[model samples]
Target chain A: MTGPKPLSNLMEQFQKLPGIGRKTAERLAFHILKADIKDVARFAESLRDVKEKVSLCSVCGSLTELDPCAICSDPERNKGVICVVEEPHDVFAVERIGEFTGVYHVLMGVLSPLDGVGPEELRIGELVARVEKGGVDEVIVATNPNVEGEATGMYIAKILGGKNTLVTRIARGLPMGGDLEYADEVTLSKAIIGRLKM
Target chain B: MPLYESPAVVLRSMKLGDTDKIITFFTLYYGKLKAVAKGTTKPKSRFAGRVEPFVYCNMIAFGKEKADLLRLNSCDIIEPFGLVRGDFEKLKHAFVSAELVDICQKERDTNMEGFELLLAMWRRLSVEGDARKQDLLLRLFELKYMSTIGFHPFLKSCVDCGGDIIGPKAGFNAIKGGVVCHKCITSDPAASRVFVGSVKLMGKSLEMPFEKLDRLKADPGLQGDIDKIVAGFVKYHIRRNMRSERFLAL
Candidate 1:
């Protein structure tokens, strides 16, 4: 026996979300149905607002409610130092650390050759333009330590070779609180190679 | 469910959902298979880093008979090939090799020769520093890989009539799968002119061992011609252009 058509439709929409199976979708749909009417309206408005209001910042490519983004617009941030990341969400990951005061350049994606992603498909040209515009001192490549990420970093360095800006890659090593014995060979080897003097 | 174990190299991976990834592996015993590694996207997951492409590992996965995707149990990395991943040129060639294997081999079809060829390519690319040697290795892998899968192009003689190909020049017919002598070239209008030197370079690269391959060298023009021929042959047989090919040109 099926319920009202509208209720089933809500459940189907919920099922389309990642990690949401049929049972979870039903549970979510029922919860929304039983919630106060005003609360449900506010929740719907919040979803709609995110879609309409949020967009990539023109200068840095991170998601922002306003043009140029808060970090890029802020005078206190170090415009001379640009940290490169793979996606928009990575900007937030770096922000959570609260230690970095530099602006960011999100490539939107990495150079995934197997998946057909190339330099032309990314925002690397925009980055070079930004750097060549001058005032930039260094570029910190903070892409992941995976093969694609490293390749992306190397390509960025290669293209920016003629420029005066310094290009540096994020160091890879064992995570904090992780045991040496538990670390993978790649991580361990990188740690040894990138070891710093006290 | 039966648990299966094999030494495999990751071909590629795609995000499955919020916290899981579907990883495709070219295994020593099982050939090409895909398995879902649950929660692999999580920062602390045990499967992290081990499932990325170019990683050679021993994997244990569980699945029922005829199941489309196996559930990954665990994997231990044998070699991550970190050096290859760090260099852009080497990494591009490595990805091309992986793409070749991914396209040519069928799912669950055991082709140990193809698997071995891929591993050898990875091993050599990881350590080989000279750019020239690296190019030769990639071409060697392409030729050997095609041969193993039964699509080896005929370079010894005329592909059409099996007559001895005489002179310092010949025409390669991508659709016909080999060199067409001057006589056969007219019949095959699609055939492209290729130097005899390029053809000999390809033959010798295939015949020579990986260690001695460095001794073989080709001029820039010869290299360009052979690159086009090998790429055309691969494209014809695979039926689609590989994404890695574009990056290799860069």
Candidate 2:
């Protein structure tokens, strides 16, 4: 624990980050110490910039430096088809796939009532409002395939049921390349239930 | 290391660190306990679907001598209860049951009756198609759960004066933990009016077997009365509003 106050303070901050332990924090601090002053300044500046610049998009709720975010502002992307995800990071996950050319709506979180997360706590109302604004054709709920996620998708469907827009949940099944023998019963059942006609 | 294994229902889970989950389970043997499932956040982790809330599984966990949180070793699902989880209304009702157990039971306290009652409720919820029946079942589960934890509201006689609750003038007092006759209604200004029929319906629901629950009937008005009485009683006893209760209106 004995160290220069500044070094210790840097380590403490590193330890606050997800997955960083005391040893890792110490190593990171020492690495910063050994690095060039300019490099460290750039690193620190980038960190500060991230905090200062990143805010949720006004339209989609995804973390972005811009108000509407690039996807929301994009002329080519289909705003009519909105992909609803649980977190801003999820937007990146879908974006990585590069197949979907639709806009996104980040729920920011799932509906977990036991943890005291309810509809009001999430971005569900915003999603409904976006759908109600009129040109939207379909909403593809891409929440995780967990109980809370499934329930959230259902809740969204119910709220949007009367709207002219179509509400659909992403299909869940065995992973590609996953062996049927190793698949759990629930996954197997879901695969069967959601099976496609060959 | 002592390995504890039991059939348990996942009450809830919370994110731990970057990849781990702290899962609370209401086990048939252990009653209620929490364990950390390592690396469960990863998409392909073995615990992916197993650690989710409302999953019923045969869980194996190991504990240190003094540490309260056990390390979850493995789990095999007994029932995923996916049918209930897939329906928003049913899911809300199921979460209410799970939350009630989490709030009322203490860690590592074994209560077989309570555990069985919860399982029965989930089983009923997963298969029962009628929405009204589902509501009735949830109310019954709440009542049964309250009694299992020793908070059973006195519905038969007056909670205040031990007098017979004879007429429509009776009121259910949440503060006093039971029904009050017309004379004792003044004791608690907040007590809501309780019809004799609603009181009798709750009593019968408590005593009746799970299979025969459908045989008991209450019109929409009576159902509403029981709902209010149970909600108030539970709110007063639990000391905090359930998060899931709000979403039930949706």
Candidate 3:
């Protein structure tokens, strides 16, 4: 037996959210149905408000309430070092670390031939134009350490090969508290190859 | 399902949804496998670096009841071979090798030699120093891969007539599966002329076991022919090109 058309429609919408599998989606839909009327209205308003207000920064390709993201507008930050990443979420990941004060150029995606995502599909040309405009000293590729990520990272390296800017890849190594014997070969080798002298 | 574990090389990996990855591996006992690495895309994911391509890791994977693809749980590093990712040329060779096994091999098909050959080549690329030297091993690895999958190309004899390659320039008929004799080259229009030196070195490389692979030699002049023949053979037989090569070409 099925619920009313509106309830089923709500379930379908909930299912569309990221990481919400069928069972969890069903649970969420039921929870929404039982929620306080005012609270539900606020949640729905927030979703619509975000969609209307959030816009991609023209300069850096990150989602922001304003045109140029704060990072791009902030003169205090290091404009010389631009950390290239695949998506805006990655910008958040780097920001959480808080060690990096450099601005970011979100590529929107990496070069993935299988999925038909090439350099043109990404924000690579904009990145090059930004770098070519001058004042950039280095480009640290912070794309994920996966195949497409690495390929995208290297593609950035290749494009900026001629410029005076120093190009580099974010180091791949073991996570905190990880044991040597338990590390994967690829990660272990990266750690070994990237080790610093004490 | 019971938790299964094996030493596997991360041949390919692609994003699945937002925070997951669908990874392909060439494993030791289980052979080729496609598994889900949950949360691999997370910033501090436990599976980070373990699921990256070119990595050789001891993987623990399990399936939920009757699922086709296993869920990758945790992994221990067996060999990262970091230099392969550090150097552009080395990275290209690694991708081609990984893509070869990924495209050609069938699931659950156990080919121990193929597994070992991949590991050995990655090991070589780790410190091979010269990019050309690292690429040289890929040719041999491709040959070995063909042999494992039961399409071993004939290098010594004509693929068409099983006769000797008589001329200084050996013709390669990728369609016919290997070198063609002077007489047989006329029989196959698809056959293209390849240097005898390339054909000869390929045969010698295939004959030697993986352990002594370094001893095989080819002159710098003949390297181009060797590359051509190998590329032709792989392109024709495999019918799929390595996508990574295109990025490297750029």
Candidate 4:
């Protein structure tokens, strides 16, 4: 035996995940160690399955167990409109609403020059090729209302310019449950700009 | 070996291989700049708050060519733009503004006006009650940006016949780059139509700054017209439709 339990190694792996701190990692490692063998096996199996089965769709960059993904393969979804999101998580988030009838293109990540992630690092060239070749009518940018995401959206919008495609971005303002009195000036202002007359 | 220092805002930041980070900056002097802050991601690294996104910092950098990615020798945090960090709406609006700077600013081109505009916008939003001014602010940036980049739309004269035009109402031809006289409109097959009233609104928008705009009550129709005109102008010059603008409009 190489000394203490492999808790340190497990914690290190957990820390690699986004938003997981060292303390959380330790807690997770301990939880996993104390869990039933069957549960542990199931967790391990799921992780393996995700890696072994999941691959990017050729049409959109969404992770899928099969090529083209279910959404891209589906005939019912609006082929004319494509909702573009920054990551796969956004794809799931939108899907949860079940409101968007259009298909999607997962950008995988947004443009962040500070991080050295640029146009080249992103799937932008692929998006252009898709736009140029595909029979797309409108492109809805569903990226996070953040700087990198906005930059990415702008870059994509410029690239797909005048190709007969109508490009759009999600409106930002007050949240569903937000109180107007508690809302700050920026939020209230954005809400007013983004308001839809019911 | 000369070291230059300037004020910059972190547009975005990401962790590099092991301990370093890559930060994209909208700088006061250089416009858009990308720098590798070595060991920035580490706990003890000096670049901690200096390179964080949405934070403004005064940085010292060393590089041979202007195009060469600079090495950050030192960074002192200025205004953190802290109001943007946690607040979602503020964060989003600030990001859109920052992204505009990133897109409009040419690398190594010193655009002090654009820099000042960004700083002013940030400062304004950081204060209370600036939200009602959001639309005006964005429009202001678009107008100022277009002016700075030499794409100021022709609002007064007939772009085609060079006729002395009346203001408060006019037509716009994206192809012709200004108010298209009724005679000129009939001549061009692809020109988009605009109203005389709409043209006046556009004229007023183009002439006035954001501060003056906030106090003035805008006719909804006029505001819509101005928005459309500015949108079309931006689309024409940027050579692409802004996807976000459309979605946000929706």
Best by DockQ: 1
Model 2 segments more than 4 A misplaced: B186-190
Per-residue lDDT tens digits of candidate 4, residues B118-184?
7766766666354435655666567766776677778777888988665444567766678887777
**Clashing residue pairs, backbone N/CA/C < 3 A, model 1:** none
Q: Write the per-residue lDDT of candidate 4 for residues A174-193, one digit (tens) a residue.
A: 56765666543434555676
The candidate that wins on lDDT is: 1
The TM-score measured for candidate 2 stands at: 0.95
**Per-residue CA lDDT of candidate 2, range B47-147, in tens?**
87788888899999999855789999998899999888778778888988888899999998898899988888888888888888788888888988888
Q: Write the per-residue lDDT of candidate 3 for residues B1-250, one digit (tens) a residue.
A: 7677899999888879988889898898888988999998765677877788888889889986456699998877777676787666777788778878988878877878899988888888787887567667877788878888887888888877888877687688787778888887777788888777788888888888876777877777677777777788888887767675564455
Q: lDDT tens string, model 1, B1-250?
A: 8887999999998888788889999999988999999987665667878898999999999999778799999989998988887788898899899999998889889899888878888898888898877876787788879988999888888988998887777899989888888778878888998888888888777777655666778888887788889888999999999989888777
Please say which candidate is ahead in lDDT: 1 or 2.
Answer: 1
In candidate 1, what are the lDDT values of residues A88-196, reduced to their tens digit? 9999999999999999999999999989999989999999999999999999999987777888999999999999999999888877777787676777788899999
**Positional deviation of residue A158's Cα in model 1 after best superposition, in angstroms:** 1.0
Candidate 3 displacement at residue B148 in angstroms: 1.1
Across the candidates, what are chain A's individual TM-scores?
0.98, 0.97, 0.94, 0.86
Better of 3 and 4 by lDDT: 3
Which of candidates 1 and 2 reaches a greater TM-score? 1
| RMSD score of candidate 1 (Å) | 1.7
In angstroms, the error of model 3 at B90 is 1.1
Poorest lDDT segment (10 consecutive residues) of candidate 1 chain A:
A178-187
